[model samples]
Target chain A: MKRSNIAKLIIALLLAFAGYAAFFIAPDEATMHAIQRIFYFHASSGWAAMEGTAIVFFANIAYLRKRTPKWDWLAVSSVEVSLAFWSVVLVTGPIWAHPVWGVWWAWDWRLTLTLVLWILYVCYLILRGLIEDPERRAAASAIFGIFIFVGVPIDYLSIRIWRTQHPQPVLFGGGGMDPRMKAVFFFCSGVLTLLMIILICQRYRLEQLKYEAEELRIAIEERGEPQITQRAKVKV
Target chain B: MDAARAASIILRKEVRAEMRTRELLQTTVTFVVIVVVLFSFAFEPSAAEARRYGPGLLWIALLFAGSLMLNPSFAKEQANDTIYALRMAPVSAFSIYLGKMLANLLFLAITEAILLPVFAVLYNVSLWPVIGRLAIILLLGAFGLAVTGTVFSAVATQARMREMLLPLLVLPILIPLMIAAVEATDELLEASPVLDRTWLMVLVAFDIIYFAAAWMLSDYLLEE
Candidate 1:
């Protein structure tokens, strides 16, 4: 009944429709048939993950400039969400690769960059966990987030200059993709982006709630009411 | 005071302290020597094989040594709360970072200078032909390592599991530098040596970008 719930329901339906479109509406590839279908999900997730990184990059810079909790919250949420999508890309990549390339992994430029990006962000999370103070954590991780994002393009360039065996880009006028396949790919990408934004919103809300709970606990402690403090602690 | 003057003063202090107790340079050189020796034993490569693999091994050893040498850059500043004292000084924060990064670069370069002849003898690789070009690569690579290592050392020193934290935070970001350094070194160490301009450019670009990033972020980085 709520607006957000209604929106969620609509997105859920569209996601299912996207799945159906990817499987059936899109034409089969001439070479790889069913296995090639993974490309739709894999590429879309990669695009969404990249979008998430851009959000995180900007959010980190905003946090650094504004020194606000909301920007930090948005950053952490986007990072976790982007990491989830990247995991999907990494997983689906090898699944598609094993059969096609005769090997599951290659030191290709894109693949190596993806792995490095995942490691860098995972370290970001770990760094956040290590700092106990919330303010320090946000500031420190923002600095780190900006540092690592700056490295991403250089990492890609270095690896690309070293070697490249991954397939060429087909999405942006590079390859002769069927119009139906292109349409399905775009549909899937749009749905996935929507899903990512929704997930980030939900995660941001969770962080807000956690902040509120901490404030309440501190207030109760300041009041020196042990009994209600215990009750409040239990409720939290 | 100008940043360069403040940085020079801090650099003098760091160099003085190290000269009084040669701890980092001595330990790092010994550590890298052991690594080069152990690697030679581990691989026991023929002269031909060593020519192919020696550069990679040498860089890996230097990377480990640099990590070890860099760990105490900020950690030791905590022993007497000297970092806070440095912060309270009238100097800019970037001066502190620049001075410390320069100190680290100096230490790593010294360690590499000592280890090179040892590595050359053990690996049966001649360095006289490519020493000039190789020095350029080593300086650029070492500068990149020192900049990022000093920055991350500051970050890691504030965290739990500080020793384990530095490498995890730094190594991934240093991959491009590592790749470029190793590739350039490999080319120079080849039989018919010719310097590859591309990897050298990559090294230069990496150094400039990270150094500039550190300079820009120095204020935030040194804050409590």
Candidate 2:
């Protein structure tokens, strides 16, 4: 009955429809029939992941300018969400590649950049976990988040040059897509964007709950509650 | 109260301290020598193969040595809370970052100067013809490394597992710089050496972008 739940229900239905459309509505490729379907998922996930990076970039900048916990929470939520989407991209790319390229992986520019982006975000998360103070952690991670986002383009350009100079077999044959396939791809991308928003919202709520719990714990300690257990002192 | 003057003073202090005890330079040079020599044993590359791979290997060694050398950039300031003293000085916070960044760049240059001959001998690559061009690439790459490394060093110094944190935070971000440096170095090591303009441009752009980013963020980075 709630607005968010209604929105979630609509997104779930739309995602299911998109799944069906990708499988049946999209015309079969002249080459690599069923496997070509993976392109829809892979490409959409890549776009969503990039969008997530953009959100985190802005969130990080806003945090730095405002020094607010909400922006930090949004940045972390977007990073985790984007990381999941990026993982999907990483996993699906190889699945499509193993059959199409005749190998599971190649040092192609795009592929290498994807892997590097994954590693960069993973490091961002690791950096966040290492800092204990909330404000310090947020500020430090925001700075790092900005650094990682900026590096992506430079990484792409350098890797593009490196790969071009050492030309590998062209992985994706360039041809005009069928209108139906194009439509399906865009629809899937839209659906994935909605899914990403839903996931980020959920993750943001989780961070909010964490902040509340920490506040409650501190308040309890302030009240001289000797009965409060210290067992939760372990660092995450 | 000039930032440039303050930065120079900090640089002078860093130089004086290092001159008193050559800990970073001595250890880094020794470590890099062992890495370069050990790499030759590991690959046993012929002259042609060494020329093909020597630049890549040399850059890897320098990267590791740079990371090792950079770890103590801010960590040492913590030992006596000298960082707080620096912060209290009547100067912009960016000066502290610039001073440390330049100091790290100087140390990396010295380490590279020592390791270049060792790499040439072990890998059987001739450097006499390409030394000038090679120096240009090394300076650009070293500046990129120092600019980012010094900032991350300040960051990691406040974290747990500080020793392990710097490399994880720095190496992934430095991949583009590494690619440009190694590629440019590879070209210079060729039989008919010509520095490719594209990779050199990439190195220059990378150095400028990171340096500017560090300058803009220096206030936040140095905050306690």
Candidate 3:
């Protein structure tokens, strides 16, 4: 095993511990007690997910326009990372919402937007699956990826502008965190961002290997004298 | 020939082609009006509710109808191998883009024009200010749509899910135009002060930016 991979594993383990500490070991909230504390991880991780997805989408656009492979690798990795974080957000939300809102999922504005954003991205991955050609797949997904990103801010704004009756944001001004809370919050968010980058690197390397293996398979098949793709000819 | 004549020549050629069968204009307008009627029947006829949803329904109907018209524009060219003919012509692809854009603008405008009075009666809102705002926003919005649409249409043609992919890809980027258009329309209907000269100027800036983009990128879309 390489050093960076080992370090990434260490960091991942640390994140798990920190996340556990934030949830259980941290001091109780002044108001909502056990439930509100979930806000720390839920909100921060959700924000991180949004950021990662945005970066993935942007990299996809750059890949499409420039016809570069590195951007595609960057994109697929970040999206997978986002899917993981999205799970964190989704899991933590029901735990928090069940006590506060008295329901697991309501048609609230925040939940709706997150749902739309998630579905939009799931469609992004499905698009990749449906296409046969890599370049075409990349270009099509890149375009849709950028589009989904544009929808996110507007989705956030639309909830604010329209009268959907969703609750206004609870956390304001650095979430009104106490000193101790702020320290832990900053620690988790920072480590998670770095953790995301490391995760993306490893995932990207795997995707590249997969792409190469696919190329080799195609090449072996073409050795039987059939042209598969105009692009695979040169790349393989 | 002069620039006006050259542009005019392109416009004339496009208009003539559409007028011969009228498929482009006919299908778009028919579908748009039907959509408006369907909206009225689907929702309750509350004046306030209809007023709020009018701009959204109007723009959405035009967009979907416009997409229908746009698909055949390029795919048909590939059908008869007319794309090579257009490519071999002395005229620039930018000219071709502008010509098609103008035709789309005309078709969309006519749809709005016919629908406005009917929508007004159904919703109990005046159509004049909306028309003025639409004149600026629709042309600007349609230009952005056409610019991006033509480019994407070319790209989608090579892909498997051209039908589904085009709208999925387009709606996200076009949200800004929709927001701006709807905001402008809302201000016009309610006569708000927020949408003064600056807002109209925004519409102008958007138009110029996208028109220039269409001009610059038209060739990239045309090249094999």
On TM-score, the leading prediction is 1
Question: Which residue pairs show collisions in model 3?
Answer: none
Interface DockQ of each model: 0.77, 0.80, 0.19
The complex in candidate 2 yields a DockQ of 0.80
The digit string of per-residue lDDT tens for model 2 on A1-236 reads 99999999999999999999999999999989999998888899988999999999999999999998989999999999999999999999889888887888889888898899899899999999999989889988988988887777789899998874222422347557888998999999999999999999999989987986786687687876633345344322
The number of the candidate with the highest lDDT is: 1
Clashes of each: 0, 0, 0
Candidate number with the higher TM-score (1 or 2): 1
Question: Model 2 off-target regions past 4 Å?
Answer: A164-174, A225-236
lDDT at residue A72 of model 2 (Cα atoms): 93
iRMS for all predictions? 0.8, 0.7, 4.7
In candidate 3, what are the lDDT values of residues B1-224, reduced to their tens digit? Answer: 34445556767877788889988777777888888889888886677777678778877877777666666656767878988887787777777766666766666667667767777876788776546655666677677677666656665665676677666555654555565667767666764523445445555555555566556556655655
TM-score of 3: 0.78
Point out the higher-scoring one by lDDT: 1 or 3.
Answer: 1
Question: Which window of ten consecutive residues has the lowest lDDT sum in model 2 chain A?
Answer: A164-173
Residue-level lDDT for A66 in candidate 3 = 84
lDDT tens per residue, model 1, B154-184 = 9877888878888888888899999999999
